[model samples]
Target: MADLYRRTVLVTRPEPGLSDTGFALERLGWEPCLAPMLRIYSVPMKQAGAVDRVIVTSGQSLEALRVALPPATPLTAVGARTAERARTLGFTAVDYAEGTANSLVGHLGRAGGRNSVLLATGRKLGVDLAAQLRMNGWRVTRRVVYRTEATESLAPAARSLLEQERVAAVLFYSAATARAFLDAFGEERGLLGSVRALALSPTIGRTLGAAPFREIAIAPRPEQQALLALLGPLPTSDTNTARREIAP
Candidate 1:
């Protein structure tokens, strides 16, 4: 049986997302240590030009470009969550794939419109999507709508829990976040040997780079629900009776 008392899972995504994930973890009876590995800063769009469609891979990109682009512009997102976010932001037409940039490329290819697409993404990111779209004969304009900078260290609470071997798992949402976490704490592989690394995707799991974790599990799908499912159900107990009622 898993350790019900030591259900601490380090959340390594950036904020806004960090809070949401933390809340979800708490509802599932896991104690979440909010440790952001990257900081996101919105970059103003200098020239978006007119485009028939917009592509957004992350909520951060959608937030950055929601006002810059027309709400009614046909928008394609990389996942359902991002697509829903686009809709909430007043986008009239939004489409999404099954939570991956590669899947998004396939979705666009099947849709078969070679129209110009404005891709709102973070700086130095989305190279593969842009290249793939161009190869498919679509006019692609890439715009850096956000910048993500790696943090120097993990949060004090997370570091303390890790040092004490109190953390049962670590949740990594992006390859960049995984890299940042490794860069900050790679020397402490011994400390992590008993900790599980739960990655949202295979790419992020690979970024963990042979870290001696108790286990490294990748989500069946590149989404939050699937990633959390890797943790399994919390042990049933009087302490978590309330949590169980609210858990999905």
Candidate 2:
């Protein structure tokens, strides 16, 4: 029999690339489904609190704030794309770092003394940012301005993709997204064992906790393209990567 997955993939991107990735996967002879496990919603201004600066680590989070906040508030973002989103959303003075929490914090250090900083993010927010900022003499606040809840039901097409065993690989961009994907399958989560797991960061891979899979590739960076590139046809030589033991 021929290889089951010559080319089909299921992508669990947060909320950014549904069309483009679908096109790419189509070109690769794979059926791509936009099983957006997490949904992004703007934090209503009525519920927002006072803050001097807003820190955005993801473009989606930045976009959510854009819809909720007015212009002129100083915005600090994680990457170029996030900065661009902020600018487009009416924040003229946008400061963005090299695209990670540590890098963004480092960039903030150079600017100095913002007094109060508010982090707008989803539910699963537990990074070492607030403590670091507090130690540095800045009052930091975490306001779950928005949330990305896992879809209760996968799209019919996505279910077919998973149930048919046509999925060759699954890409996880964030630890939260990975959890959402795992939850989407519920009790049948083991079905995912047949698909290779790809993660954008080691943080995401570690979240897998040894899920039954032969290969789990971690992208060096958080870029979508980089993550996808790592997923490109697994090498056809002596396999050096070890199998991940899925924890129950």
Candidate 3:
């Protein structure tokens, strides 16, 4: 634990997304390096009337849905936080999916009533969930609620810390952000040798394939709490490396 306090972590998610992890890292005694890999912009979107259901794959999708989606419309959220946000925004019927696009697809498939619906997402998005829904016979409308752009480069502080090997861990929340982070540092793989890459899911860990990380740890579940829990153990501990806390 003392060794953890002496190192910093690179936070690569967008602004609000980075804040919660930042606070969590601070409480755990690790300095946070705020280097947002993605910048999210809520697009001006306004729709009227109600639909059969709504599918939100990310929290940022709510940027437009909060106004466009009626209070009574049923919603399928891809993550726990996204479900909670939907309910808070007045959606009464909310179905929660584990943090994966496939899981969300399964929920709609089982529901068997995923007919015509709005698929809220970012301008620059990952996982062609909308296309998948269409293939599954659901009439999906692509709604670009927000825009996510990659940061041109890492912040000076973040770059300095990374180059100095001062950061102990780098938390990755999504493959898109991971790709953006990788792009920012393009080919400077050795600089990351001292850092552990903590990924929120196996898909994310796979997205970082062959990166020059000292080690990679995938969380038991694709949730924020699960991701943070992986950091609770000592950095040198390998018993839990590459293993999900739950049986796969």
Candidate 4:
């Protein structure tokens, strides 16, 4: 733990939520380098029809949907954090998926009675969840409540720190951020080679691929607590061979 002191960890999430990650890192005595890899901006979309259930892939898309949809509308989220946020927003029927939108789609199919759903999502999506549900005969009202453009550059401070080879670890919350980070820093393979990547899920790790980091450790869960758990000393290999998440 002596080596963990003040070690810089690059946090790549959009603003507002970026602050949350910063605070969490600060609590752990880790220096957080803020270099948002995606710009989350709200888009004015219409109020969804009799929204039987609301599907939220990203927490940033919640605000727009809350305003557009009714208060008591049931909500389903891709992660625990999003589900918790939805519950706090006066939503009673809040459920969460352990994984991505694809996981949520399967969860919904078995949950039953979620006939009509307003999928409050960002413009950019890794999986076409709406289309998947539509093919299965579910009424999916796909609402792009937020526009996410992949960030192509980092802040000068973050860039300088990376160039200096000072970034010890990187925290990736989403697949989009993984792509964006590589987009901006793929050329600096030398800088990236020594850094450890802590990804929120398997998909995020796979998206990052094996080229960038010395080692990639994936959290057991997709929640913040799970991601933060990897802040300590990492093992040489994972014991869970059946679910080999870590990539070398």
User: What are the per-residue Cα lDDT tens digits for candidate 2 across 1-248?
Assistant: 22434255667765555455666655544556556667766555335567788888776676567766767888888887678767877888788887677877788783354578887765656257767767777777776656666666566776676677766688787788788777666777777666789887888998876566557888887766677777666323323332121111
lDDT of 1 by residue, 1-248 (tens): 44655577788888657778888988887777777888899998879677889998888897778768778899999998888878988999998999998998989883355488998899999998899988987888999999999997776767777787777789999999988888787577677887889999889888886688889999999999999999886544434421211111
TM-score for predicted model 1 compared with the true structure: 0.91
In what order do the candidates fall by TM-score, top score first? Answer: 1, 3, 4, 2
Please rank every candidate by lDDT, starting with the best. 1, 3, 4, 2
Higher-ranked by lDDT: 1 or 3: 1
Give the runs in model 1 whose Cα sits over 4 Å from its true position: 110-114, 240-248
Lowest summed lDDT over 10 consecutive residues: which window, candidate 2?
A: 239-248
Best candidate per TM-score, number? 1
Where does model 2 exceed 4 Å of error? Answer: 23-31, 46-52, 67-70, 124-127, 233-248
Q: Put down candidate 4 lDDT per residue, 1-248, tens digits, no spaces.
A: 42333267788887646878877876666667777888878988776668678888888888787677667777888878788777777777888887577778788774346588778777756248888887776788887888888877766777776667666788998888888888886566566876789999898899878456878999997778888888784332222111101110
Candidate 4: 10-residue stretch with minimal lDDT: 239-248
Clashes of each: 0, 3, 0, 0
Give candidate 3 regions above 4 Å deviation. Answer: 1-6, 46-50, 110-114, 124-127, 234-248
At residue 115, give the lDDT of candidate 3. Answer: 78
